[model samples]
Target chain A: MGRWEPNARERLELAALELFRERGYDGTTVAEIAERAGLTKRSFFRHFADKRELLFSGQEQLTRLIAEAIAAAPTSATPLEAITAALTALDSIFDDERRVLARERQAIIAANVELRERELLKGTVLTTAMAAALRERGDPEPVANLAAEFGGLALHLAFTRWIEPKAGEAYAKLAHQAVDELRATAAELG
Target chain B: MGRWEPNARERLELAALELFRERGYDGTTVAEIAERAGLTKRSFFRHFADKRELLFSGQEQLTRLIAEAIAAAPTSATPLEAITAALTALDSIFDDERRVLARERQAIIAANVELRERELLKGTVLTTAMAAALRERGDPEPVANLAAEFGGLALHLAFTRWIEPKAGEAYAKLAHQAVDELRATAAELG
Candidate 1:
């Protein structure tokens, strides 16, 4: 609190998102983002390494948050409950503005194959991170890993449904229902 | 039988596998594979669209085999049991020249992100196809789709474990054990 950064990063991100949505990721450049933010390219470089970096820069933070949430989950909670709590924590971070930002981010990533691959890799990283966090909580290793994998798969399924223009209600609510349906399906199969 | 065309596709597939094993996927070319098969480039194209197509050329046949297996399963059999039978059918196809081909195909795809995405998409396609097959056999749609997705996830997890360089004994056996473990884990959590 002693030093306020004046939301420079948020401003940069918003400006970049607007420009990217208007001009497309390839058509827009770091220079454009910087100019829109009333900053120099040097300042932009200090913030992000490149154009793609801006799109993915929040992933590390998100991963850290998920990890922390999982770690802080009650020991008596079942694996699924722990996971749901962690996801709920993530939902809070992704309020309306963040959801819009994420939708745009997904749009840009979806249109580009390389970006999609990077997004997949990012997902893999988050899964691995979540698994590691579960293991740290003394869960059995393979089960812990699989639990995280299921969480990831569930998230993807939920998000895919959420992004559809026809999807109604809140994303978290849809995600919770999807998880319940998935669990019911899995149990019936089992 | 008289107009068999001498199983030209199989010959070309064998030739491609040999060339890939000898020089790796990147080092091998369509022309080289054709030359090794003692066939013209046109004949190679007749058999496969490109070198990459070789990786998935048998997928259609394998899907049909899996569908047949699932269809033939007893109605009294549980969902997991039916899906296990389908996986067994898949194993028969992969186990013939499994050691080299499985590892080689995996390595080739893992090294390339686009190939991995295509592989995932192919897996999703197969899941949809299997789900449709299950529905045809009297299972409800949502349950059928979930069964297919669960089976696919288990298979992917099992294959990842089975393909480890140090993974010992028969892969089919390992896969069966992995499925059992997954069922147990799901039960425990449920």
Candidate 2:
């Protein structure tokens, strides 16, 4: 059943994720993923340079979109509103169709030491981009940097809650609540 | 040289850092470190499991102190205040005598991917402990978790600023400012 599929990237991603889950990330091979997707190893290479690239395929595009979204947010938007808008856009990006894959991706990342470091580096990249966006909006450097960092942290915490197996809160709702609580906490500081 | 040394750990740490900076982390060996410190490799291992352990030795102690400080904050303390107080205690722990080692340790961690991952894991452990402390303060579980994560992120950012080579800002002052801005950004959400 080697029928041609136009969405080879998507097919390879699904196959890789399945294989990674069943066999564990280190145990999965490029050839195995290609075979599962009804494609050759060459085709898999076309889609992803390596196994790690398969896991982070959309990272660059997603980071860019989020940065631009935050930058294009209304000037009248409060820092929290601006950050919230950006985070909500991220939620929209992680729709039901992507949630399962995202969860698997998150799990793989959490379980691996090297992947976790890359994840932190990615988070730093996004935070830096967001801070730059804020700075372009006339916010001071340190404030913009700190706001993006703290806001990103709030969003990350909320995402953790949203992804929890038994968590009752909705993603957007919990994110908003988290931002509020974070603000309140910051207010109480000297 | 070893005969006059009262603090073997301190002596070994300094020797290691100096060698690491001069020859790079991979270039420096335990034998060289021990030799430079006028001790044996056996003496070095007695104090540390390996070179990496020297980089993280203070991290464990600092995290423990922060955890305890957060847990013991006044019942009436607000979230940020409690976190700030914990960090202030941390700053005191990183007093003048410790600052040089602290900077060197950070530099070493920065230069290595594996060390950075270990450092991130260490920070994650501290974040978890801090969250447990906040939960014990009788706050709602989700809020407590979010607060702990936010505090960790803020502290990380503040530490980033403090470590900048040409940064003129004092660690305590920069940290206070960063926390203040975090509160303002949070208030903007309202």
Candidate 3:
């Protein structure tokens, strides 16, 4: 019963973020979000399990994207190399439009401890899944784990910088910079 | 009014773990833990905020230990070097007796999803604290962050192995190995 079926999900997400910003996350309701999106609560539920899911909906897709990229890396790639390649693929997932909303969403999360814990949990799961993918691709136990942790750190490093970046800055460049910093950190620590 | 007065806190910890293992964490009671430890509920509350805290009481001390170590490292140390020094300081905090209890607690946590999440949250807090300490020591923003993440990973790598370590392996040695692996992961990724 929504006017636009094709972009109902995207519209709901935008509407939800606006409401979350206008009214604190706890103060917002699904009905308000749905109404703002010109949709019904049913359509909202069909897209997201609950209000919290709006914040975390992308976690599943992001994890899958990284895992698939890791699994698809060339056979000649080293564990870190494979991971870097996988991370590079994430650069294009966000464009100019998504960046503005990402900053808003981050503010909401930073203001709430429960949301931050969920973010940490999601990060842990992403690291675990990336490690599993590397293991599946024939990496060793702890090495795979360490490499996956690096991958997670690299993505976070890049993603954070990409949040409120300069007008012309690219996400991939930030990722590469994060990768270099991680390398220097490792080398320096050693 | 119970039998044991001295080392009541220590005895309560052991007894709580024992009862948790025997009766499960959810089934065990604060009063029961107190009774098993030969102490009063007053002493139990004095030692721990709640039952879930029984397994997590060390979090505050551990965070303090790592943060103080980072803050106290030589001023000339690079961020990574400072973190290495912080990680090195952790070796003396554990003895064989504590290791046994830590393993028991980790087992209980691994068996439950909620407990696992709590453990992960504690780890996140420890990392944030370490990062904050690094920043205090004059490390630049991202450098401090990367160093803290490395520090967190190093502690995790060492602590995890120490839980089920080989008879002759040392905690500091494992920490060094983890540092080396992190370095190599970064190098390989680069």
Candidate 4:
């Protein structure tokens, strides 16, 4: 009822995820999510443009985190090293609590065509951000783009592994391992 | 009009592209497209599910072409070699005629957010197909995926270059160049 509501955004996201899981994404509604969150529809709108946006709320922040990390890598770092730094920086957000949410979110996306497409589009955007950052670091064409893609691939593989129910490795460590595996694979591409 | 028409699919696609260029994708209607193509709505429906499908009609064929090419590569071929064969196989479709259409299609997709998202989704699907094909060739987990990602990146870079107004190189040549450039870039990723 008051203008100041604590954790309104987080509450709405949790409510939406719960409703989506219980009734299916298509079966859930914005008003129902707001009601479940004990928040007003206006407050829900203030945080997310739509139900789908709730699932992807942190994309901009994640992009910024990656770009900044790549930029902040030491000048002597190779493109892959810069990418490794960016991937490691993601540990700040992929904590245990977020991992659980990620697992649920992945299942929800897997079951929905629209959400899957949106996820792919988001991945493409992140890859483009990584490439731009690499270019800014003076890595040339094709190399910058290719290295960014490798970074994107590693991030995806690491996230997938980290979200496994029984997986015990830290996200950053998994990312480093994935990048090394990809490098070895590339080396064997003769 | 007879139920059977010559070049119905191609006509519908060309008409749709022209209308989308002049009236914008959102502004153009299927009825208008059919009319412009000198056909009825029923005829248009017979050829395509909708206006968007016209631009993406060859997706299945392209997927098949790449998969079959990879599968047919020599048993001793490296993962990247198989990918190279698949890229070269694309010359069967990327002829001079398709080049013009590709340019127009790219412009239309660039101007429309929905189309751009759809394009990105298609790219992801193709990448998945490439990875699956590599896996079938006995390449390991991350290796299969990494090689496929590299192939997808090459296809994208080659396609972008091929669509440039002043580009003179053939699509297949550009594709080979892209793959080599990516390989060199990967080797330098230190």
Total colliding residue pairs, candidate 4: 0
lDDT of each: 0.75, 0.77, 0.83, 0.91
Candidate 3 residue lDDT tens string, A37-60: 988999999899998988999888
**B89-175 per-residue lDDT for model 3 (tens digits):** 777776676888888999999988899999988988988887899889887766777677777888898888888845446778878
lDDT of 2 by residue, B12-117 (tens): 9889999999999999999999999988998889889999888778777778888788878898987777877777667766555555666778888888988986
Model 3 in CAPRI terms: which quality? Answer: acceptable
lDDT of 4 at B160: 95
The numbered model that scores best in DockQ is: 4
- Per-residue error at A161 for model 3, in Å? 2.1
- Candidate 1 local lDDT, A91-145, one digit each (tens): 7666655665778789989999778867776776677777788888877866676
**Superposed model 2: Cα runs more than 4 Å off:** A1-6, A40-53, A109-121, A157-190, B1-8, B39-53, B107-124, B153-190
Docking level of model 1: acceptable
- Give the better candidate number (3 or 4) by DockQ: 4
How much is A76 displaced in model 2, in angstroms?
A: 2.5
The pairs that clash in candidate 4 are none
User: In candidate 2, which residue pairs get closer than 3 Å at backbone N, Cα or C atoms, i.e. clash?
Assistant: A183-B186
Interface RMSD of each: 3.5, 4.5, 2.9, 1.1
State TM-scores per candidate: 0.71, 0.78, 0.86, 0.96
lDDT of 4 by residue, B33-144 (tens): 9999988999988878888888888889889999999999998999999999998999999989899899999999998888888888888888898889989988887788
For model 1, residues B125-147, the per-residue Cα lDDT tens digits are: 67767788788888876568767
Per-prediction share of native contacts kept: 0.32, 0.20, 0.38, 0.86
